[model samples]
Target: MCFKCCLFLASLAFVYFAKAFGGAYMKSSITQIERRFDIPSSLIGVIDGSFEMGNLLVIAFVSYFGAKLHRPRLIGIGCVIMAAGSFLIALPHLLQGPYKYETSVSHNKDVNSTESILPCLSNHSMTEADDTPDLETKTACEKAAGSSMWIYVFLGNMLRGIGETPVMPLGVSYLDDFSREENTPFYLACIHTVGILGPMFGFMLGSYLAKIYVDIGSVDLDSITINYKDSRWVGAWWLGFIVTGTLILLSSIPFWFLPKTLPKQGQEQSESKSKSTELATVAEQENFLPEENQEQEEKEKPVTFQELAKDFIPSLKRLFRNSIFSLMILTYLVAVNGFIGMITFKPKYLEQIYGQSASKAIFLIGILNLPAVALGIITGGFVLKRFKLGVIGAARVSISASVGSFCLLAIQVFIRCENAEVAGLTVSYQGAPQVSYNPQTLLSQCNMGCSCSMKHWDPVCAYNGMTYTSPCLAGCQTSTGTGKEMVFHNCTCIGEMMTPGMNTSAVLGQCPRKSDCDRIFKIYMALSVVGSFISACGGTPGYIVLLRSIQQDLKSLALGMQTLIVRTLGGIPPPIYFGALIDRTCLKWGTKQCGGRGACRLYDADAFRMTFMGLITGLYFLANMLWGGLYIKIVKRQKKLALRNQAKENGQEGNGAVNGHANISIAKNKEDEERTGEESTI
Candidate 1:
């Protein structure tokens, strides 16, 4: 490759890294944004889908017209737009006030001692004029609570989708056009290998940032009631966006200086020599054919818009007519839908199923799973090149990896941790599975007289191992300590345990599940990493199959169309539907101070695992079925073509032998006649 090609490759790699970083960061921060905005999972799903909506808007037009335009400059413009979107996403963090997590525990020392008074008694001394909820107070509170800053995140993500339009189609096509054919796979693999690192780093960044409080620099750590493990905890999710945006802006600069096109490396000279040799051989075999040369030149002429428009329908028709290509697209669509849904909610699933904190989940996925995937992709590409695999070999590799991954996913369905023993949701106060759910079920005889509001979700784990809705619900007569260390004493709920001389105190936190659950979680993560690695090994080969199946002229359009369909059908809907389904499994919902439902605080683990893994497994099963059929078709066709070529070669050799014998016989006859005439003259 020339200097410009090298620069273009580097620029494209940088853009890939930037975009992947931003996208993965968004995924990693989904839980934080949900908690910060006090939105439901379904609504967060819609916000996530907005990015794909923006992609749907301009991808087709950009992909088609970009081929005729300056591809490098266009990609640079896209990077700038992406950077702007990232900045927009982070804007809400700057504009919004400091993060205030929802908590029922009073910040005042006096309020913390309210248990000294009878639980049912209202303290006149505590009531003040400003504390009264007058009409003005209500209105002002509503105004402050109604801050719809989440809209900024949605719009910013959408802008990111629009900005990302040119990166894949234009960048890949430009690279393919300039590089030697054999080197294309390795080049792409290197780009993707570097690109995968972006997500790895992005998720790691998310994990690191999640550990710090959202108001880290401004707030006192002692005053904060929650830790990173708390469901209500909100981290500095916006920081990664700003960092990625800056990198994207920097990545765009080099592309501006790079040329629009570069000569194909090494192949141009060889191709020219081959063409000249073929023409000379043709001239010796037959008279020079000017008409054929003119026709070949005409075929190479640049297509006008009018001509292109007329042929557009025909081109599309021809593209879909290829059975292998169409099947590949379908299979990819199914696989993408499953992959998108799984990745979008994997962290949340881990939190709910395995009783892990969001930070821990994101961190594990970043450190363990993403690197495995990156290695798998690189290995897949290397396998393809090293083995010199054509379509059939690539198909086999793709199908084998996919099926192997699916089998591991199936195993995950069996190796699951049990449901969390949350009070009155999954399990009864008696520490047994509940047959049915009712809000009134929370009102056990122990604390019904305390008049606790079921809406308040201040859980306290009693000495008996059962959790209560709040310290008030636990009928705690006294309290000690403060913040996270605070404990409630003389709890009536623990008294119902009927244990002789047991301490009847409850602490200010949810009850943790058995340690066996943690062991199960570790096993699950191990299986997850292995499955991810195996599945990702198919990615490069599958992509190569898609690229090779299409006509060279329509490579950009084919890729653009594939993205359009997969993103529209797969990207936009998976998160929405997955979130909506997962929302159904929520056992406890958080409440906003402004009198509305917030994010889910707890989930039924069994139901969540079943739904999440079931959906993924079903989609993969379908995709594998399609792959099976595609593999059969590809192998049969390849075998037939091989036989046909072999037969043609045999026929050509036979004809050459006959022609050689005829030339030798004529030469012998001419020599023999000359010798006879010379003897007669003598």
Candidate 2:
């Protein structure tokens, strides 16, 4: 490649990296945002889908028009817009007051014991004068009610979608146009490999940040009641956005200096000379036109707006006429739907099913999963180039990878942990499944005299393996230590549930599951890593098929159309619907301080695993069927074309031999006739 081409490729790669970083960070922070906003999974899905909504609005027009305009500059402008969106996403954090998490502990130091304090309890001993709220207190309470700030996050994500519209279509088309035909795959692979790194870093950043409290610098660590493992814990999610936005802004700068077009590397000079020579040779051989006239015709032809407008529909029609390209789009559409949903919720799945903290799940995905994907992409590209695989070869590779990955995913359905044992939700205080959803069931006979509220969900795990909704429900009269370290003593519920010789005590935090669940999680992670690598191997080849199947002129439009279809159908809906289904598996739901249902605290693991993996597996299986049909067609078409070309060459050679033999026979006859006439005259 020329220096300029190299620079443009680097710029494209950087842009890809920056965008992926921001996008992945957004995905990783979904759990944190859910807790921070006290929103359900379904609502979070809508917010996640908003980015695709923005892309859907402008992707087609941008890709079509951007092909004709200055592409690099358009991409640069897109990056700026993305940066703005990122900043906007973080705006709520600065504008809103400090985050307040729900807890059972009182803020006052004098309240040593929480035994007397019940959820929504009011002291009737107070006089009417004490019951009245002051005007200042009322005003402060009203001002603090800013939980609706999640709207900013949704708008910001949508804006990000708009900004990302140009990057893929424009960048890929630009690289393909300027680079050598064989080199295009490797270049794209490189870009994607670098892009994959962004997610790794982004998720890692999210993991690190999730361990830190949302109000770390502003709040006292000693006063905090919840750890990162707590369900209600909100992390420093906004900080990653700010950092990502800045990087995206920087990535846009290089594109401004790049030219709109660059000469094709290694062939620019030779191609011009060869074109002129070929034209002259053809003219002389056919006796058709003068060399000067041909030269004049070859000179620059200015394209007008009218001509471009007229050609647009015809170009689009020509593009879809190819059956292979259309099938590729359909197959890709299904695959993407599965992939997007899986990646978006994988961390949450890990957290809920395996009893992992959000931080740990995000960290493992970033550290292990993304790197494997990156390697797979690069390796796929290498295999293509090393083997010099044509269309058929690429298709076969893609199919193999898909089949292998699908099998792995299917196996995942069988490997699962048991559902969490939460009191009053999944199981009763007596360690039996509670099929009914009744608040009254939480008020057991053991703690009925304690006056505990059924609404409170501050669970304390007793020594007997059964958990209580709260220390008060456990009928604990006293507590030791404070914050997360606090332990409840003289627990009546524990005594009722425990065996004859066991101690009657309970501690803060929910009970941990069996140790075997951890072993299952490790096994799941190993299979996940291998499956990710195998599945990602098909990515580059699949993309190449899309690129090569379309006409060169329609390359941008074809890619844009594919993106539009996939984003609209796959990208926009999966997160929403997947989230809704996963929400069905939530065994226990958290309660907001302002009085409404919040994010899910726990899920039925077996149900969650079955739902998530089953959906992905079904989508992949359907996609594989489409791919098989496409492959068969491709192979049949290639065979027919090969036979036709061979027959044409053979016919031309036979005709040339027959004509030569006839000329030789005619000359021999004429020589004999001349010799006979001369002899007779003598």
Q: List lDDT for all candidates, in order.
A: 0.80, 0.80
C-alpha RMSD of each candidate structure in angstroms: 10.5, 10.7
On the 0 to 100 scale, the lDDT of residue 588 in model 1 is 76
Displacement of residue 610 (Cα, Å) in model 2 is 1.6
Tens digit per residue, CA lDDT, model 1, 510-540: 7777789889888999999999999989998
- Name the candidate that leads on lDDT: 2
Candidate 2 residue 355 C-alpha distance from true site, Å:
0.3
How would you encode candidate 2's per-residue C-alpha lDDT over 63-150 as one tens digit per residue? 8878887899999999999999999999999988888876555544444554444321222232324434577765565368567789
TM-score of each: 0.87, 0.87
